[model samples]
Target: MSPLSPVLDGPLQRSWPWLLAGALIYLSFGFTEMMGSDLWWHIAAGREVIQQGSPWLVDDWSFTEQGSAWHNHEWLADLLFYGWVRVFGVASLVIWKWSLIIATFCLFQQLLTRISGNALAALLACTAAVAIAAPFLDMRPQLYSLLGLAVLLELTLFRSPRLKALLPLFLVWVNLHGGFVFGLMVLAIVLFPWRECSLAALRRAAFTWSACALICLVNPDGLRIFCLPLVYALNADSPYRSLGEWRSPFEAGGITSAWYAYSLVIGAALSLTWLLPAVRRRVRFSPELVAIAVLSAAMSATSRRFIILWAMAFALLLAPFAGALLRQKLVQPLMLPALLALTIWGGLRVAPYSLSSGIAFHYLTAEYVFPHGLADFVEANDLQGKTFAFYNWGGYLHWRSDGALKVFIDGRANTLFDDATYLDYVTVLGARPGWIETVEDSGAELFMWPRGRNGVRLTRGLLQTGRWRLLYEDVRGVLLAREGFALPVTLRLPDDSVDTQLTAAYLASKKGDTVATLAAASRAHEQRPWGRATCTWLRRSLQANGQLREAESVMEACRAYFPSKYLR
Candidate 1:
């Protein structure tokens, strides 16, 4: 009998309700606020593409590389986002994001079910995969690459492989996102079969692989498309490598989060299946799948971006064993209930944070994560000139100002920026020696910067130079202009929001100005009496000012309002 024959007669045949429940629960995990930093520029770019006839190949959005070549790999995806927003409104992008996520996971579950013949096992594997992938599933072009991979695996790796469909898939995928490189790698791996090394099978796989690769070149980038990944990898001096997503999980610290640890465990388990002959004999995993799983795991270990791919591969490679475990005497009786309970627990944990008041998506500026307020101040004052900005806020500033305010750098990174440009940005941002000179040399009239820990040194340095005058300040960002620069009006502490007060407290604490820290923290606590972070900051500031009794009182209030563990 075929491996899938038993599925028709198994409990899965009657488990539609359970599968539906699992899918809904999985969808809940993604219902958080849309807060991707790069998303703003994407929308802006998409708008430009729709208004114009074609995507701009030159970087006109930044002052540093105004005419530099921009390898716009994700133009198609950006256009789609723009179309969705234009027709259905901005909130629709959230729905679009969740739709892609659900589709990808659905494909994963289907593939797992076909391979393992156990819907319950497939569901459990998908849940584990979701746990690892949830953090990285922001609304971006990368989502297309993820969904593409899922579809590719379903078509190529599952029973009766559809090799011909991959050509068109790659043709479209190359335009959607740069992740088509991974799909090409997977196709190449599948060219060689594990046990049966037939010449005909080899020829077929070779033709499909070559055809898909050539189809990828049909995009706007042409031959340059193939060179993009290489450029990112080979550039040793590129500051983009220092980004958190690019760093290896083993670096700085080893396997910090439970999700990373879980991925490692999955990778190790897959490796052991090949290393141990006994286990290999028991589990009839395809060698190509094993190779793909190993490659994905290694890539994920080296760079965090590949974790979702590894998670998908993990479900594919281990589903059979997961199914076998479910059938075991000890597990079979309790498996269904345990899985349901676990799903419920996960949903409950996520729902509190995921559930929002409304679905109208807005740029996330909370805690200075973005420069929404600074951008507003600049636009309101008609401030225009070369601006030095925090790197993360580059996209938002460009989008919000509609290209009136160009930035030194943005999320485009290697796509438009060279090593020297990024290095200069890094030097000035860190307030390294000669930073003031670098800023002066750039002729930047305005400085749109953060006020948090990352920007504290730079903010202090700008103040000390006595050349940059503060134009605006908020909880998240500070806007400054060169001496004698024109300004319509200056709004200092524009609102008495808790975020502004918290920024004040942090800056004061950094300078060891205990009196200012205490005053700011006290105001912040009053503004946000129930906020855990605000409470903690207030308590610490009070303790620093030698008010032990007041600090104790703040801690007591904090304890009353929040969980004891949160106080710690």
Candidate 2:
């Protein structure tokens, strides 16, 4: 089959609404200008590979695990994404990201249409699948996985069963992402005899499955690449426990999109099995769908990161049964069109004010920009000694420091850093016991805390010690150096509405400047009433100003809202 074979060659009358809905869903996600936390390191590694003419074989980004053996499994993917950034810039990559996503959903919708023979069924299924997978969509290696899965499913379900087309698919997939193993697993499941399949069909599937597995070794790392999955599995017990993506979907309390998708998929399965047995009988449950569904469900339950993979399988497996059920139960003419319009409108409302804003060369934002500034200060001051860094900012720091500076940890999680390092990070950031000892033992010369998350606790703890000096502070981040260490520039933070006021409150109390402190703190509190840091600052200011009644009122409000021991 040609490259465009998966795209439907049919008329637009029935397909356009479903396609439009899918496009809207994907665009909503793609419009966000922020890249994934991992994108920075990937691009950095890619740039290294391009310039140095060799792939990174050992860890160099972190201070703790520097020179340790590193697994550059997705080297090819890194090269491709970075190459795109070099050629067309980040804005073009954003467009390219959305294009790939759009193509993936188009192929998926085409596959659903083939299976259900109902446009409305395909539309609803595609919309739900996109919704479930929306959060994971970005300019990352996973985009290739999405596209690859769509093509793989189309070939397995819609096209003739042949091993020839799958060889090249696996060849490309192995280099793109480690998720290729998932595709092989799905194929293995499809090869199993759940339904009446011919001997020739079984032989072809067996050939394709084995060939794909063998082709996975075509990468630079060769056979060692097979161990990537094992590394990821072992991460379950590592620092990944604290990361949101690694958490179980059921562990979260609120109603996230994953919950909705999970409920729908599980509900559809149960309803088909028990409530609508007649529909189940009519709609043949193929071996491929059954295998994909079971495997995807188990994986999704274990890790929320795999929910998109499960969502893809869910959309495909449930479409036929859902179509049959809907056809018999309801008859409405404008329902599909209305759904398309609503999805488009929702996507529009949620899209960034400018689709291309802050999406060139780098995703510059207040959250990420502050770290870059801090890194610049660190470089200018020649403070390349041991440094404690926020976990998420490690990637950006590694990229921005031109390989001259190393971090305590990065987004690699358990893949590189040990569990102890992660525990120390959490302990220090949370102001727990052993935190000061952790910092002292590491021989760290300076610490950089992203202000939004851990800055308040860290800043307060450092102030209590009196051993560290505040060097630089901003709404995005705060930097502290060991006492007696001189900075290249004077210690003066920019006057931002948030961090400036909070910092002023802290500094004023230290200097016994009640009037200035209270004024700054009160303004910050009014600007953001919910922030614990602002509340803490305001309360401290009120107390330092000799306003015991107002300080108690602030404390009461804090207890009412946050109810944390830190406030007490």
Candidate 3:
């Protein structure tokens, strides 16, 4: 057969529109560089498993819970992730993640095409789903969750519902990640209300759901894996709830334009049924569809993280309505023109035009993911033991420290910590009542917090306790030591410059060491002779440290440095 024959008449010829459309979706999403902070710990955990040959029952990266039992359900996904790194290196992990994302969209598009029949509607729905789901597209196990959901729907919902086919899927799903529970829920909803009197279909569906439920027990955790989803769900007070991803889409504020676009697509797609009576009539509403819609919507309303799942539900449930709307008497006239324009747009986006900086390979660089400088300083200083850090920075700390230095918390959240732990974290970070006592109680030796509302407040509390000394301060994060801890002599030395003396004085004041700050600032002023800045800084530092008497002495010294200004 001629090569052109396949393009002209084969399955490839028939599906080229959606094939191209899926390619466009993949390219658009692939262009986004994966730079998740939590990727570090996941990678580290995977490496740990590779080294030890088993998941650690006790915590590996937290000082407070050093020996606490840990349940790493995503071990299989982590193994695959780190396996990619082992085989091809870090750069290949990026490609691996991108390949998974693309494959997910491809499966989703195929499912949509089967339901909608119209390629344009499928493309539009998939585009909106991709846009909404973009935030969750990190190089984490959640990528597997996305792909698994697509495959589950395609197999059970769209194709022949075989009981045996679903068992292996669930077996993999259960081991791959805790998201297997989501698949179980979807399966139950789909099978529970089979109105068809056909006994055989009902038996098959029932057997399929039962088999899925049973196979979930096949994981390493056995029975305990069943309780995990419930534990994760009931963790309402988790400090992770403070993260935007964990908040409800409605309650989540400071949204970008992409969210608005996603909202518009959802609204427009769902409204078609109501606006056009014929479209509503065309839809074959099943019990499964109704259940999924209500459940997915409720889940999405509870947390922004579920919005992607809800988006997929919407695309699957409303594809027929969208397809009907596209074929409407009023819409058909414009469909061809719109399709042509959309096709051109898709082609342009997918084509590698090379006008840009050649696909931004710099996104995965050290400057973005790793805290190399801070890690070096801490390692050099031998700063180990309990280290308090923001959740965002915790993963990087865990990874770079090679499990040697332990953090108080990390991105693992429900996997490693309980609600009480997260509550204590939130309370301490908020600088609320008993915050200083909480910090002291944790027995953490070092505090490293990123620059943020909570981090800044917590840092202030750490400094005010008169029990910590500043070690490193930068825009990215600050590292402080518990008092009585000695720093290297080189780090402790103040430079001769006025600015350096001021910085040193500020740090000393934070430590409540008024005498040291005053002496350092005095020396700097004495050297410069005409250094008004050093004298002013000395006076301020003394006042800040509550040395009123010595503060007056510095003020008097300032008059000597700048008589004209002091006299005024």
Candidate 4:
């Protein structure tokens, strides 16, 4: 073989075919799953960058906190993702993700190809690459680190034992994503005194390590970005705790999970095997595979999310042994490329990336899915002040709502966000006293409820006794005005015709009595003291609470008796 044989090797020797194969598996796997909030947030963040011409670090539109701390570490990736989604819509976003996966496979193959000189080792390494990278198949900036780290590992570990030569690449990897911490660890591993090789290998590794640190200074945050890992890791209950990916090692379940477990198992066996009184492979796991194995295993077992760590180490471990396992004859070269092309094709087909549509994905501004319609209703009814929201709807409401409507709570889980807030949030909606307490303390001017329920005690209790005015209730959302703001209790006497009639109808509706509903709505129409507006509120309350038929009957009767053209 010539000096550049690895680069110019034959189709069977190149290992590019296996790269295509590994990437194909990932592209295929992701196609069947739904694109989660990560995709939308990327688009949303991009818009912020475009609108502000800079990164965000505070809650701009949020009514609760105007200047809460924010993090834009993945700002660059989000802008690229937003721009792509604008151009091609979801298809473009999908393509970007798939392309990253394919590139990861190609990089892993290329690195191993140079080191092992065995085409089969390159192929197996790529295969192991696919197996390990399974859980990270989302539209997250983290993908940048995933692929970059794979390339970084191959360069630092398998081929040259010199860390200095690998520093420039490490710098690029660091600037690209926070996963650079793992890359730094790889360098330090090579520089350590291990049972693997002679002093010369460590010297080469140490030099590369020094050069890489220098290159890291070129990024935007300077060296501060590199230091953030320790800070973030130590932060209490940062998604790293509750989320499964951040958990301890692999336990069981899922199609792709076992790939990580397999590598941990195989690597431990091989690393221990090196201590045998036989053929010394002149190499040992630099950072002590046993420790990484235990940690990675614990992470995998605790959360499915950190499977990336398990996969990464597995890929590095497989690089040396690829030559032995992947020596089988190439099946069909054409099929491999076909898979690669299809993987790319499928990804582009899924991500909704387009600029002119003006319709952002749910994640981009999830809080504003139907802002105009919902906001107009609130304004027309004068529904404002502190309101309650479901668990994940806080960010959405905060973004879409006007200053009048403050939220009881939206998604920001602040330690300072009083325990009363959290308790009432779950209680009020679930109809659990604290409901009234949460409602009162939030200074709630409106209670937004999901469209149809038997009788949500929080909102219904207020409406039945005239404590709240049914200010706005449509199919999308419900808005109730606290009595003092819109209508005082003195304004609504029990037998005062309109008030009595509407109150009676509300009570019957709550009791599931259809017969009494129609009769009460009739007498209520006869006593329309506030004119058409009161009648309108009655109809809206009935229809919004699943009394559409009674609302129609009241409308018909009001038209027959008063015969006003404006009612139409």
Candidate 5:
């Protein structure tokens, strides 16, 4: 019952490996990418809540979605993350992210070690879990779900089978993310025996599950926020199907750790089930293990994201069976020579693990840096006005800019912007025909793009137009603006030209004409698929169209023909 008892009462030998595993797990998160996309949108949403001093009732932040339903479901995480940024700046965000990751993995590792004495097996499970979770790793509310699941799992399996501890975890998990429902579902799986569990334990788990469901009432939005998890799937025919992470499993790689490890595990257990068919069988197939095995099997054929869920489950299930196999003298230790070869290979040949140079994933490299340079430029010139922005840059810009420039857009996404506002901006960014005109019309006095991109090929061309001028440039980025310190004619873009086509397609996709946009972009690609700007815009157009598959198709074509021109 005591928190310290797990550490203090245990001898140093057992706890040290678990603690070392914890340290290594947290170290892994250092390389995980920052949450830049929807993660930022959450921060922006939280800021509005902070300013308004009220939870979102009807949406009111953007000029676009003046009145619409906005689910600030992650209000708690948003506020906490946003507040942390305010207290310690972005460095704190990174710290918080890595800390959560380390904490989650450490807990999971502990549970796994509790079930399986093999530290190496536990390490493999966590490492494989990290690989599948790469896509979604970052500082997010959902991490709370992952961490809570570990706690929930421990209580579900290792406790007195009384199911008394489930309520408090369930209550906290509800505020963290809708992933708590997953914990309840996991509980149901662990308690699969409708007939086997004592009536008291069944009643307790049911009451705990109900209590957690009811605890959603304590959130900022009251009982309404509970609808968010369900409502998120309305437009999604199968939200899980559309989203790789939510899919049942095996969708990622059927042969992932589950099949390889789980089958090896449960198969051994099943083998023993008949081999020793005695009441005193050293290995017992608890319903929990069977249920976990079923989930693992399903997820193995689903998406890579669910690999973590089953990896931990199967690892635990395998421990007892491994011992059972050891009893029959079936388990074999590595040969001395082979063991040395593996150790040497692991150290010299394997370059993946880095205790020295921290390897960064693409998100960290692609994420927006604080625009200290641009902010300085505006402060020096004192010529600030509304500016256009990319989705990626919009969030950090909003955080650091101090309201000097009203961003043409920020990370609020389409839901916050409604159809027309989102598409209109999408149109302008694509340099669609009359995009310059659209900027002028919006009174966008300045332009800013991610540094090193050279996105606007016309940046140098604008030098002669006298309608717009290059204001500033830095190693990090650049800035441009219209003449008369006001919006005016800039370089004229061609009608139905590549830029125009890109702009139109981009906007149309935002307007929900995703298919037409994808086809148009595909047609454009047919002419010059490898063109730098064309390929660049083509990728966005594909993503906008929700044609990730087609996007990959174009990218493959571009990379095949022009290796150097890959859109990255």
Candidate 6:
């Protein structure tokens, strides 16, 4: 009695190659550099677990919260990542991430094909899904949750109406990520027979839900695993809420381009599902799909991270409607192949940029995104003591320095440090009134922070106090040591690349050395003329040195190279 059952016979049967090719190509978009900050900490924790033979329940990574209770969810996923890196290598993680993404999408594609009974319709939908998911497809424990949700949906919705498989799914899911709580909510929705409501069905659902809930307790956290979601929720005043991923998609300045695309696709799908009944008259209503969609959409409204779950629910809900459209005689011959061609074309365009041409593993640490160079300087000079670093750089510093530099704070956020500790960190980082007292009380010997707008004020405050010496600086980060700190080796500035030149220009400008600023900025601009930061710096440096004609020429060149909005 499926709405798409009528479309079971068609030319779409012969279009499997096109569908497969397009799916592979579209999924290929996930292959890129490993850029996430969380993965380093996850790998570090995984190594610790492997060494200790059990997950650590205390925060040992940071000096700020040395003995604090840690949730350590995703321990299993961390172990898997460590084992893969141990056996295969770090570069192989990119492949591991891609494989999980492909498998997740395949599950989604399968669900769409089963519900819609059309491969072409499923391919088109999945292409959009991949686009929506691309930004979040980094190599992290969350990838396991994504794959777990897809498998859960496949078992409950696509396969026969049975809840037996959910036991094993929840058993593994509860350890892999805290997202299992959301899965449990989804299972509750799927277990209820919306089409046929009876006492027998309700009783069966209750039994299955109880069984799944019990199975979730098999992890190391025991009963504590179920309370993990509540732990995050109750920490309403936690500084982690400032993170963009935790922000609502509808929040001002929080909406991403990807969320916009997701909205358009979901909106179009809902329109088709509701309006198509007028044209076809035989369109069927699925109350279960509607209920799940409402739940997921509500969650997505609160946090952007839940949009992937909403995408999964909406896709299945959208399938039959997509299939119904595919069945029309006029649409079948003209529309299907055109959509396939467009998907293939998109795949071809993205493939070259997406595929790894042998993994450049150093890019993970070497890139400007991290403070790898500062870490190198600290390690080479054998510098030691408690370090206060940017929140994002803590994991990299911990991993790259091999625990030699104990950080004051890290990405562990609410899991390790409480709101009071985070507020103190915020106070010092922002260079607020009590920042000096806060820093002194913490006994931090080394200060490492980004050299960008966020850290410039803190850096200036430290320098102005005459108690913190500038030890090292790069385009991305600056390292300062408390006065009287001994350096075994004399500190030297690296003049190797545009990054260093830009940093030199910035430092010179701060000291009112116009000639030095212009010199450094000119070199940086010549090296990377297309760089927005470099161009802007070079123009300002030229103007400061009284070269107005040259500054105007640089401005004209920058305007030609970039959009007017970007120049502004």
| Best model number under lDDT | 1
Better of 4 and 6 by TM-score: 6
lDDT of 6 by residue, 194-306 (tens): 76679998888788888998999888778887776645434456567766767777776532536544554665567455656574464466666777778877777667677
RMSD of candidate 4 to true structure, Å? 12.5
What TM-scores do the predictions have? 0.82, 0.77, 0.75, 0.61, 0.62, 0.82
Candidate 4 positional error at 135, Å: 3.6
Model 1, 510-564: lDDT tens per residue? 7899999989988988876656557888899888888989898988876555333
lDDT of each: 0.72, 0.68, 0.66, 0.54, 0.55, 0.72
Q: How close is candidate 3 to the true structure, as a TM-score?
A: 0.75
Give a tens-digit lDDT track for model 5, residues 195-283: 45687867776775666567557766677655545433333443223333445343452223324444445545653464455722555
In model 3, the Cα lDDT at residue 434 comes to 90
Over 4 Å off, model 6: 1-11, 14-19, 28-35, 161-164, 230-236, 258-281, 351-354, 357-366, 484-568
Which is superior by lDDT, 4 or 6?
A: 6
Over the stretch 179-220, how does candidate 2's per-residue lDDT look in tens digits? 888888876775554455788768776776778889888887
- Per-residue lDDT over 282-314 for candidate 4, one digit per residue giving the tens place of the 0 to 100 score: 332234444454555555455556567766566
The best-first sequence of candidates by lDDT reads: 1, 6, 2, 3, 5, 4
**How many backbone clashes does every candidate have?**
0, 0, 0, 49, 12, 0
- Extract clashing residue pairs from model 6: none
Q: How far off is residue 272 in model 1, in Å?
A: 3.2
TM-score of 6: 0.82
Tell me the deviation in Å of residue 122 in model 4: 4.1
